[model samples]
Target chain A: MSLDKSVVNVSFLEVKVWRGKDDGELVSYQVPGRENQTVLDVVSEIQRSHEPSLAYRYACRVGVCGSCAMTVNGMPKWTCRTHVKKVMDDGVLTIEPLRNLPRIKDLVCDLSPFIDTWQQAGAPFCGTKTRHEAPANIDPESKARKAADAGLQCINCAVCYSACDVVSWNKDYIGPAGLNRAWTLVNDARHGERQSTFDKAFGSGGCGSCHSQGNCTRHCPIGLSPSESIAGLKKSALFGLPKV
Target chain B: MERSLFLTQRLTAMALGPLVLVHLGLILFAVKGGLTAEEILLRTQGSVGWALFYGAFVVMASIHGPIGLRNVLREWTDLTTGLINFVTAGFGFLLLFVGIRAVLAVTQTATQISG
Candidate 1:
């Protein structure tokens, strides 16, 4: 007897995917399960075979791009790296867009508000040197450089923003990710607008607004601690206060 | 105002941490010893140590409570930040006045007991 070797044996996985805009509902779909399937893979399978209209964002499937962040089960996670076997409960998965941001469509949240907060926090780097001047050689062993390195891994994933309770409550809050960026700039010796950055950081809806709830640090995929960064900003605010 | 208030809150919190433990420890000691109010007052009467201890507690609480309330009001209500600051600043002053007066009243009564 000849065995049917061409057929692939696949088990089905139950997946609950969020559908529609902000007012949308979760739609359940049965997807073919494979070994080492990631949450992103499950999403792709569902999008490829069952529903072609499902919308999600991702790049660098190896987890470096940091764009595939979504709420898995109840926590924000980098979908590309979150394996289905690890997060699935009773062989079921719940996938939704990141929280605390406006959902643009199915599994997609508009990141404008999150990105705009960077500007509000004065996170832009301003350098004083012209092309004619030699480059500023910053010592890696310097205290400020070490401080900047502590929070320099953020990829604008918005996971910290979604995780922050302050962001949800205060519409004006700069949020963790933004303030964390400003913190790096504050410690950079090459940054020209240190005072202005400190001004914005110490301003209303800035670092002072963070209650140190630690949600940002807790949810960051890169393990950067924004809570500590905010605490540092709170301490630095004393220097900025005399001007106010 | 936000920056100053944040700094004050942190400063007061640091002060309160130790003060609260001392206050609690004193209360526990008094309770365990079954000391009555009169007995406790007698112990505190004309004691500069007790006066300074309670004085710091009242001052720290006055600063800490209002700043905490400011954060709560901002989170729980739609009140503008300016209005919230105005109210919380007023509350802070009220707390300081009331707290200091209470401290003074207790200390004065203790002084009378000694005199």
Candidate 2:
């Protein structure tokens, strides 16, 4: 976590970083190698000593915040949790912004498109009950509740979004994360807009667009299976919605 | 609607799975038995079972093929949804017409056969 340049290093790691917006090239820098260093640590070191203008994002420096997600060596991952030794190839590291979103700068992408798709899929939960009423008793062990719980822990990191090929090919298709969010809401007993949510999920560029390639599931840092969530949505369409 | 199309595609696919296996098995049986074209025609001729089986196959295939084509065209091309639907519907009708004619030609009795 320390960027202090006074500490001498016995070995150096060649790190290639994307330097600009969409038209940028990978600029190389020799970073001091350290044991137990994360990819975020390397990027921070490069910014501290080599290029002051290099732009990227990170917070909490731990796995909790999903902001540090980027394409490392051709795979979408949470750079904060990814160690340098595990991802580097031939003593080299390549870092770039997450794909399927507009690049704002070097490694910072505009997350508006990702957020907008979530809204389009009716991901925002609509509450049917107010504070005055007692909370709805949902059995956690129920099939619908279990299905909902399976996808409820999404961090909205867009790692799955970046890994998805459907998003790259079909501009209108709401990607896996959004569909996953919709699925959780669909299974909820208290959501007032279940029908609308179903309509939105099955509409144009909805769950039907997913090819079930499992890229979203495979690349997810939180281990959530958006592919499974999407399949559940399709299954709901086949057999009517599960009775909550 | 997309939901209807999705459901239809899946249901037809389920139907097609067994139909295709039976069709392929029939092909192998005929080839192994060294049955000539005339011999195959004679067996199929005037048989309502063969007629109904092939009729169902053609109908399911006609419905199934274009729906899949619609999905592929929507994903891989710049065509409008309306245009894609139109094209796929036309393809389905074409398949039905040609498939029905072939089924009739094979299954019709000798007395019913015409030029």
* Top-scoring candidate (TM-score): 2
A1-244: candidate 2 lDDT, tens digit per residue: 8776644755899999998998999999999888788999999999998899899999988788788999999999899999999999999899999999999999999999999999999988889889999999999999999999999888888999999999998989999999999999889998989888888999899998899999999999989999999999999877757678
DockQ of 1: 0.64
Q: Could you give the CAPRI-style class of model 1? A: medium
Give DockQ per model, in order: 0.64, 0.80
Clashing pairs in 1: none
Each candidate's fnat, listed in order, reads 0.82, 0.71
Worst 10 residues of 1 chain B by lDDT: B105-114
lDDT by residue for model 1 (A1-244), tens: 7863432587788899999997889999998777788899999988998999999999899878889999999889999988898888898899999998998999899999999899998999999899999998988888778888899978888999988888888988999999998888889878889888888887778887787899999989889999988887887865652111
lDDT of 2 by residue, B1-115 (tens): 7888888989999999999999999998888868798989987999999999999999999999999999999999999999999999999999999999999999998789864
The residue-level lDDT of candidate 1 at A47 comes to 95
TM-score of the A chain in model 2: 0.95
User: Each model's TM-score, in the order given?
Assistant: 0.88, 0.96
> Quick one: RMSD of model 1?
3.7
